[model samples]
Target chain A: MVINVKNLVKRYGDLIALDHFNLEVQEGEILGLLGPNGSGKTTAINCILSLLKYDKGTIEIFDQPMSPDAYDIKRDVGIVMQNVAVFEELTVYENIDYFCGLYIADRQTRKKRVAEAIDFVGLNDFIKFFPKKLSGGLLRRLNIACGIAHQPKLIILDEPTVAVDPQSRNNILEGIQKLNRQGATIIYTSHYMEEVEQIASRIAIMDKGKIIAMGTNEELKKKIKSGEHINLELLNPEDLDLEAIKALPHIISAELTDHQLVVKSGRDKNNLIAILDHLKDQNIAIGKIYSEPPTLNDVFLEITGKELRD
Target chain B: MQVYKAFFRIIQKNRSQIAIYLVVFMVLALLLTNAYTPPQDTDFTKTRFNIAFINEDGDSELVDGLKTYLGENANLVDLPDDPQQLQDALFFRQVVYILRVPKGFTAAMLNGQEVQLEKTIVPDSPSNIYMDLLINKYLNSAQTYFAYLPGLSQDQLVDYLKVDLAEETAVTVISGSSHSANAEKSGYYFNYISYSLFAILILGVCSVMLVFNDTDLKRRNLCSPIRSATMNFQMILGNLSFAVLTWLVLISASFVMYGSYMFTTNGLLLLLNSFIFTLAALSISYLIGNLVKSRGAMSAVANVFALGTSFLSGVFVPQELLGANVLTIASFTPTYWYVKANNEIANAVSFNAGNLQSIFTSMVLVLAFGVAVLGVTLVLIKQRRVEA
Candidate 1:
C-alpha cells in the first residue's frame, strides 16, 4: 500500500470527528473518498497527513509511520486543501516556485518543474498574475499547481473541484488522471459523486466518521440489491399486469402509477426481457421504455437508506 | 533559508508604507531644526546697545564718570532733540536706553546732598535694563567710595571704583564638547525618528505577520515539510533584517542631514542608545504582531501601542514636564527607558566610564523590557500551539 491508515480515532470535545477511521490507497490509483459535508473525510485526511493529533491508530505512508517531523514521508506527499491556499502577495509563478523549492532545492530542476506544473494546470497565461487577480477556477488551479509542482509520489486532494465551473471541473479531473498516469498515487475526496465515479478507480463511502463501504463501483453496486431500473409507459395496464410483472424472474418489485409501469430488479438480473414477454402475452402495448443502471447514488441510498446528498 | 528569503520578499513589498514613515520623519526633522534656536555664546558677547545720553548737568567729575560709564556700556548717540524721534529710535530698537543727568550745578555732590539721576528706557527691553543697572552701580559706588576716602579726589575715587567693578570673573561653562549643540539637536531629531521607527516597525512587521498568519496560508505552510522552528526562525531573521535596515536608513539620513559630527564620542553614544531602542522596538512590534489578528487589528495596535508609547515616553512631552503619575506609568514601558537613555546621552558632559555605565544600564532596562515582552509572546505562541 502506498498509504495505509488503521483504526484512527479523533475527537473534538464531545463530538467524535473520526471514530475508528481506516483507509488505504494503493499505488498509482485514484482512491476517491466520498461523503457528505460533515463526514470524517477531511478529519481522516488530516490524520493521515499527520496534520492533526489522533487519539489512536497508525498512519503510514510508504510503510513508514507518519508524523509532523516525518520529513522523508512528507517530502513524498502533496496536498491540495479544500480551501484555496495560495499566497495573495506572490504571483502564480512565484507561489509555485516557493512551495516547490521547499521540497526540490535545486534551482534549475525546480524552475523546470514549476514550468511543467504551470503547463499542467493550464495556467501558462496567468503565471505572472497574483492569486487575488485570478478567477475562482483559476485560483483553484493555482492551488493545485502549488501543491503538486514538486511531483510528490502520493497526492491528496480535498474537494479540489468544489465551486468550480463545469469546464474547470473536467479539466481538474483530467489533470488528476494525468497525474495518476505519471505514477502518483492520489487520494481524492469530494461530495460530488459523479466526479468521483468518473475518475476514481476505487471508491470509499464515508458517513459519520467511518468508511461505511469501500469497493470498486461494480463491487459496491453488488453490495446493494439494486440493479437496473426500468420505467415503461403502458397503453393498457392493470393490477393483474402489475402482479404478473412483479412475479417475473429477478424482478424485486413492479408498480404502475398514472399509466406508467416502474420495475426494480436485483443485481446482475435482466428483468426487461422477462417483463416484456409477460406483457406481450397479456396483449399490453408499451408507449415508451427507459432503463437506468444502478448508479453510485443507488448503491449509497440502498446501503445508507438516505439520499447520497443527505 | 528559503522561508527567510520569502519572508523578506513579502516585507519588502510594503516599501510604500515604510517610505511614508521615513518621509514624515525627514519632514519633522527639518521643521524641528528650524523651530528651535539654541542661545549662542556670541549673542551675549557681541552686545553693544545704542543709547541716547542727555547731559542736563554741566561738567562735574561725578557726572563725567557717569557719562563715561554709560559710554563704555553702550554707543552714546546724541539724545534726539524731538520726543517723537526719541520714541521712534526706542521703538525701532536703535537705542535701547535714554538717560538724563539732572542739573545739580556741580554743587550737590560737593556738599553731599541727595540726588537722583532720571532714567528713561523702552519698557521690558533687556538691554535697557542691563545698561541701567551698570550706570547705577558706577555712580553709587563712586559716591560711597568718596564718602569714605575723605582724602582722595573725585577722579581717584572713580578710578578705584572702576577697577573694582570690572564685571569680568572666572566663569567657565563646559558644554560637554564643541559639538554638544549638534548632538543635542540630533537627539531632538531622533525623538521624531524614534516615533517614526516605532510606527514603521509596528505597521510593517504587523502587515507581514498578518499575511503569514493568514488561515489558509498558515495551514498550507504547516502541511509543508519544513519544520515549524525553522519557519519561525526565518520569520525572526526577516523581521530583524527589516528593523536593522530601517535603523541604518534613519541613522544614515541623520548623518547626512546633521553632518559627520554625529561620529563623535557622545554622538556615538547617542547613536548606540537609539540603536538599542530600535532592538526594543522590534520586539515590541513582534509582540504586537503576535497579538493582532488582522490588518484592522494591526492598525489599531500600531496606533495605540506606537502613538501611546511615544506620548508617555517623552517623545511628545519632556520627561521633566510630565506629571509624576504619568512618569510612574511610563516607567512600565520600554520607550520610557529608551527616551531616558537618549536624554542622558544628549546631555552627557563626557563619555566617561560612569556615563557609559549609565547609558548601558538604561539600554539594558529597555532590552529587558523587550525580552520580557517577547517571553510572554513566546509563551502565548507555545500555548496556542496546542490548537495547531
Candidate 2:
C-alpha cells in the first residue's frame, strides 16, 4: 500500500475534525475522497500528511510511520493544497524551481524537472509571468506544477479545481491521469461529484468526520436501492393500464403524472425493453422516451435522505 | 539552505523600503549638519552695527579718530533728523543698534572730568546695550592712554592711541579631543540615525515576514521535510543580513561625511553603539510581525513604534530640554540607552577603562532588550505551533 491510515482522530476545541478515519491507497490508483463542504476530507488528508497533530491513531506512508521530520517519506509525497500557495513575487519558473529544489538537490536535475513540470501543465508560455499577472486558471495550474515538479511517488490534491473554468478543469483532470499512469498514487478530494466520478478509480464518501461509505462507482451504486430510471411520455395516457406497468419485472417503483410514465428499476436490471414491450402490447402511443443511470447524488440521497450539497 | 536563499530573495525584491530609508537618512544627515551652528563659533567680522554719527563740535583730531573707529566698527547711516524714521528703521529690523557722539566730547575727555556720551537707542534691546558697553570701553582705553603717556599735544595723543593693542596681546589655544566640536556634532547626527534605522528595520523585516507567514504558504512549508527550527534559523539569518545591510549603508554615509573626525576610538564606539541598536530594532520588528495580521496593520505598528520611540527617547528633541519625568520614562526604551552611550563616547577625553565600561554596559543593556523581545517571540511562536 502506498498510503494507510488507521483509527485517526483529531479535534479542534469542541469540534471533532476527524474521528476514527481509516483509509488505504494502493499504488497507481486515483482515490477520490468525496464529501460535502465540511465533511472532514481535508482534515483526513492533513492528518495523513502529518501536518496536523492527531489526537489518536496511526498514519503510515509506504508502510512507515509518518512524521513531520520524515524526510525520506516526505521526499516522495507531494501536496497541492486547496488554495494557491505560490509566492506572489516569484515567476512561474522560479516558483517551480524553488519547490522542486526542496526535494532534489542536484542543480542540473532540478532544472530539468522544473522544465518538465512547466511543460506538463502546459505553462511554458507563462514561465516568466508572476502569479498576480496570471488568470485564476493559469495560477491554479502553476500551483499544481510547483507541487508535482519533483515527481513524487504519492501525491495529495485537496480541491484542486474548486473554482476553475471548464477547459482548465478538464486539463487538470487529464494531468492527474497522466501522473497516475507514470506510477504515482494520487489522493484527490473534491465536493464535485462528476469530476470525482470521472477520474477516481475508487471512491470514498465521508461525512461528519467519518468514512460513511467506500467502494468503486458500481459498488457504491449497489449500496443504494436506486438504479436506472426510465421515462416515457404517452400521447393518450387516459387509457393506459398503469397497474400492469407497475407489476413489470425488476420495477421498484412506478408513477404517472401529466401524461408521463416514470419507472425506476433495481440494480443491474434492464427494465427499459420490458417496459416498451408492455407499452407496445397495450398499443400505447409514446411521444418521448428517456433513460438515466443512478448518479452519486442518488446514492447519497438514498443513503442519507439529504441533498449532498445541502 | 534553499529556505534561507528564498528568504533572502524576498528581502532583495523589496528595494523600495531600503531606498527610502537611505535617501531619508542621507538627506537629514546632510541638512542637519549644514544647518547646525556650533555654540563656540565666533567670527565677529561679519557683524556691523548701524549708527548715526553727529559731530556738532568743530573738527578735532580726537573727534576724527573717534569717527574713524566708529566707522570701522559700525555702518554709519545718515538720518533725516526725524524721530519716526529712526523708530521705523529699528522696528523693521533695518538696524540692530544705533549710537551718537555728543558735542564737546573731545574737550571733556582732555580735562579728564566725568563726562558722558549721550546715546539714542531702543529700550529692553540687548544688542543696543552691548553697543553702549563697547563705546564706553573704547573711550576709557583712550583716556587712560592719554593720562599716562606724555604727548606733544592732544593731536599726538590721538595718534598714539591709534596703535593696535589687541594684536600685541593675542594668545593661541588648542582643544582636546573631548572638546572637538566636530566630534560632538557628529554624535548629534545619530539622533536621526535611530529614527532611520528603526524605520528601515521595521518595514524591511515586516515585508519579509508577510511572505513567510502567508497562510497557504506557511502550510505548504510546514508540510515540507524541513524542520521548523531550521526554517526559523534561516529566517533569522535573513533578518540579520538585512539589518547588517542597513547598518552598513548608514554607517558608510556617516563616515564619508565626517571621516576626518570619525577615524578614532570614539568613532568605533559610536559605530558599535549603532550596531547594537540595530539588533534591538530588529527584535522589535520580529515582535511586531508576530502580533500584526495584515500588511496595513504592520505599517501602522511600524510608524507608531518608530516615530513614537523617537519622540519619547529624545531623537526628536534634546534630552536636556525634556522633562525629568519624560526622561525617567525614556530610560526604559532601547533608544534612550543607545543615545546615552553615544553621548558618553562623544564626550570621552581618553579611552579609559571606566569610560569603556560605561559604554559597554549601555550596549549590553540595548542587546538585552533584543534578547528579551526575541525570547517572547519564540515563546509565542512555540505556543502557536503547539496549538496548530
Candidate 3:
C-alpha cells in the first residue's frame, strides 16, 4: 500500500469532521475521493498528510507511520492545496523554483525540474509574470506547478480544478494522467463526479465523513438497482399510457412530461428495444430517442436518496 | 535556506517603500541639524551702557578723575545741558543714564559735606543698576579718603580712588567636555532615528512575515519535507540580517554626516543606544506581524505604534519639554528608554563609571523590553501552532 489510513476520527468541538474514516491507496493507481462540499475529504487528506491532529487514527505511508516530523515520509509526498498558495511577490519561475528547492537541495536538479513543471503546466510564456498578473486559470496552473515541481513519489491534489475554466480544467486533468504514467501514485479529491469518473481508476464515494461505497465504475454501478435510462421525445405523449410502459419487461419506472417520455429499467438487455416497441404499439410518434447508462449519480441516489451534487 | 532567500526577495520587492522612509528621515535629520545653532562660548561678559556726563562743576581734579573712571565702563555721549535733549536720549534708548555734577561738588566733598549728583535714567533698565554700583564705588572711596586722610589733596584722593577701583576678581567655568556643536547635531539626528527605525522595521519585517504566515502558504510549507526547526531558524536569520542591515545603513549615514565626531566617546555611546533600540523595534515588528491579519492592519499598527511612541517619548519633542505625565506613560515603551539614553549620551562630559551608569541602565532597560516582547511573540506563536 502506498497510503493506509485506518480508523481515523477527527472532531471540531461538538461537530465530527471525520468519523472512523478508513482508506488504503495501492501503489501506482489514481484513487479518486468523491464527495460534495464539507464531506470530510479535505479533513481526511489533512489527517493523512499529518498536517492536522486527528482525535484517533493511524496513518502509514510507505509502511512508515506519518507524523508532522516525518521528514523521510514527507519527502516522497507532494500536496497541492484547495486554495492557490503561491507567493504573490514571486514570479512563476521563482515560485516553482522556491517550492522545488524545498525538496531538492541540489541547484542543478532543481532548475531542470522547475523548467519541466513550467512546461508541463504550459506556463513557459508567462514564466516572468507575477501571480496577480495572471488570469484565474493561469494562477491555478501555477499553483499546481509549484506542488508537482519537486516530483515526489506520491502526489495529492485537493480540488485542484475548482473554479477553473473548462480549457484549463482539461489541461490539468490530462496532466494528472501523465504524472501517473510517470510512476507517481496520485490521490485526487473533488465533488465533480464526472471528473472522478473520467480519470479515476478506483472511486470512493464519501458522505458525512465516511465512505458510503468504494469500487470501480462498473462494480459500483452493479450495487444499485438502477441500470439505464431511455429518454424519448414523443409527438403525442398525452396519448401514451405510463402504466403500460412501466409494465414492460425489465422496466422499473416510467414518466411523461410535455412531449417527452422517460423510462428507467433494471439490469436487463434489450430494455431500450422493449420501450421502443411499446411506444410504437401505443401509436405515440417518437421524435428523438437516446439511452444513458447508470451513472455515479444513480448509484449515489439509490444508496443515499440524495443527488450526487446536493 | 529557501525560506531565508525568499525573505530577502520579499524585502527587495519592498525596497522602494523602504527607500522613501530613508529619504524622508534623512531630510528630517538634516533639517533638524541645520535649524539649530549651539552656543559657542558659555562665558560671562560685562555690559557697557551709553550715558551722557554733563560735568557742570568743570575741569576740577576730582571731576576729571570721575570722568576718566566713567569712560572706562560707560560710553560718555556728548549732549548739551538741555533737559529735553537728555530726556529724549533716555526715552529713545540712545543713552540709559545722564549724570549732572552740581557746582563746587569737589569742594563740598573736601569739606566732608554729603552732596548728591543729579541723575536721569531709563526706568527698569537692568544695566542701570551696574552703573549705579560703579558710581557709588568711586564716590564712597573719594569721601572716605577725604575724611580719614585729611592731609591728602583732591588730586591724591582721585588717584587713590582710581587705583583702588581698578582691582578685579577672576572667574572660570569648569566642564569635563567641550559640548561641541557636532555633539548636539548628532544627538538630534540619533533621537530622530527612533521614529524612522520603528516605522521602517515594522513595515518591512511585518510585511514579509505576513506573507510567510499566510494560512495557505503556511500549510503548504508545513507539508514540505523541511523540518519546522530549520524553517524557524532560517526565518530568524533572515529577520536578524534585515535588522542589522538597516542599522548599518543608518549608522553609516550618521558617520557620513558627523565625520570624526561619530568616533568620539559620546558618539559611540549614541551608536550603542541606537543599536539596542533597533533590536527593540525588531521585536515590536515581530509582535505586530503575529497579531495583525492583513496588510491594511499592518500599516495602521505601524503608524500608530511608531508615531504614537515617538510623540509620547522624545523623538519629535525633547523629553525635557514634554509633560511629566506623558513621560510617565512613555516609560513603558522602549523608545522612551532609548531617547533617554540618547539624551544622557549627548550631555555626558566624561566617560567615567559615574557618568555612564545612567546611560547603560537605560540601554539595559531597552534591551529588557526587546527580550520581553520577543518572549511574548514566542508564546503567541506557540499558542497559534497548538491551535492549528
Off by over 4 Å in 3: B39-43, B47-179, B386-388
User: Which interface RMSD values do the candidates have, in the order shown?
Assistant: 2.0, 1.8, 1.5
CA shift of A174, model 2, Å: 1.4
Tens digit of per-residue lDDT, candidate 2, span A66-144: 9877878988989999999999878899899989988888999999999999999999999989899999899999999
Q: How do all models score by TM-score?
A: 0.80, 0.78, 0.83
* Quality of candidate 3 docking, DockQ: 0.50
For model 3, chain A alone compared with the true chain A gives a TM-score of 0.97
Question: For candidate 1, lDDT tens digit of each residue in A153-186?
Answer: 9999999999999999999999999999999999
lDDT of 3 by residue, B222-263 (tens): 889898668878987888899988888878888888888888
Arrange candidates by lDDT, descending.
Answer: 3, 2, 1
- Per-residue lDDT for A240-309 in model 3, tens only? 8888888887887888888878888897545887778877888889999999998898888888889988
Q: Write the per-residue lDDT of candidate 1 for residues B1-388, one digit (tens) a residue.
A: 7677777777777778778877887687668755766555532253788888887777677678777877876789985567798888888878878777778734676667887766678887788668867877886786677688767777787778668777675655664444767766777777667787888899988988888777677767777887767777888888889899889988887787667778777678778878888888998898888778988888787778878988998987789999999999999988888888888887776778887888799899988987887788777755553243
Q: How far is candidate 2 from the true structure (C-alpha RMSD, Å)?
A: 8.6
Clashes of each: 0, 0, 0
lDDT (tens digit, per residue) of candidate 2 on B301-337 = 8788888888888876878788999989998999988
Evaluate every candidate with DockQ and list the scores. Answer: 0.38, 0.37, 0.50
**Residue pairs in candidate 1 whose N, alpha carbon or C atoms collide under 3 angstroms:** none
